[model samples]
Target: MVGDDFAKLFRTFEHTAFRLEVRDRYDASYENESLRKFLAGEPDDLPWIQDWLTMISAATQRGLRFSRVRVVSLPLTDYSRFGVWCSQFTNGAGEDIRYLPRPEATAAGLPNHDYWLFDSCILVRMHFDDGDGFLGAEIIEEPAVIVEHNYWRDAAWHHARRREDFATEQRIERY
Candidate 1:
């Protein structure tokens, strides 16, 4: 499914929509312009960010929690740095975004692929290409898979640091 479908699913979740992002970089076409600007040391603003913030705010206002744990490498990639900068918007909008260094995430046995677990049940496994470009998502409903994802989410969240704290500790400037 496309991202819009995921957004729709977010609106339907009753309690939580948790995401585990286990990627060092993403090369989605839509993000190219913003990524380029960030690499050039320009302001981290992206035109599409407000729309996402609005969605997150709306969900959280309804008492539905939205959170994500991003697994990043030590000497962060440009993409990861950009993500750290942009996270302030999401965090401000009430999403509890966190970051876990790759080494810690791997040692914790977190899954290699990215996924979104909604309401602690449905799992949407996100697929990407060799260059880390998004392909699509598979909606998995099997109880066993969902259970494992829940476990991974719990582990990752436990080991992760809130984005603000992580950024400060790592000396990552927002702009």
Candidate 2:
């Protein structure tokens, strides 16, 4: 399954793990309890979050770069806001997180789907349902596809603002 593939890739990648996330809201299964707690104004002290942070930190300490660009729309949705809140933990774990407004991302011609590119070679295109529930991922190893995704990543990265800067601009209160 693609889920297992993602875990394998995450553990075995040699250099960089880059992700481009382009969704406003995700299904309940994708967010469940943490999102509920966040919406209810609870502190972000979730145990699973710490586990993810530990994984990211270990990867970074091994010299593997982790970065992500999240494309968001104006008048943020609840999920987007939660994502911004979660960015604090990920950024602290040495993952470079950034934000790109949807209008800007559209203007730059980036794809609408989400994907993960590992070491600028293996491309894993992620699928989602109409309601934004994760479906799965498809691994694409073609040179041309990889090259195109690499180009998109560079462009998106260039236009995205760092998480801290974006949080300040968006007036998102950091916990």
TM-scores of all predicted structures: 0.94, 0.95
User: Against the true structure, whose TM-score is highest?
Assistant: 2
- Candidate 2 clashing pairs, residues 3+ apart or interchain: none
Instruction: Tell me the spans in candidate 2 whose CA falls farther than 4 Å from its real position.
Output: 28-30
Q: Ten-residue segment with the worst summed lDDT in candidate 1?
A: 41-50
Q: lDDT, candidate 1, residue 117? A: 92
> Per-residue lDDT tens digits of candidate 1, residues 1-175?
9868866897788999999999898776777888888788877567867888998999888898999999999898878888998898899999999999999998999999999999998899999999888899999988998999999999999999999899998788864
Give the per-residue lDDT digits (tens) of candidate 2, residues 83-118. 998898899998999999999999999999899999
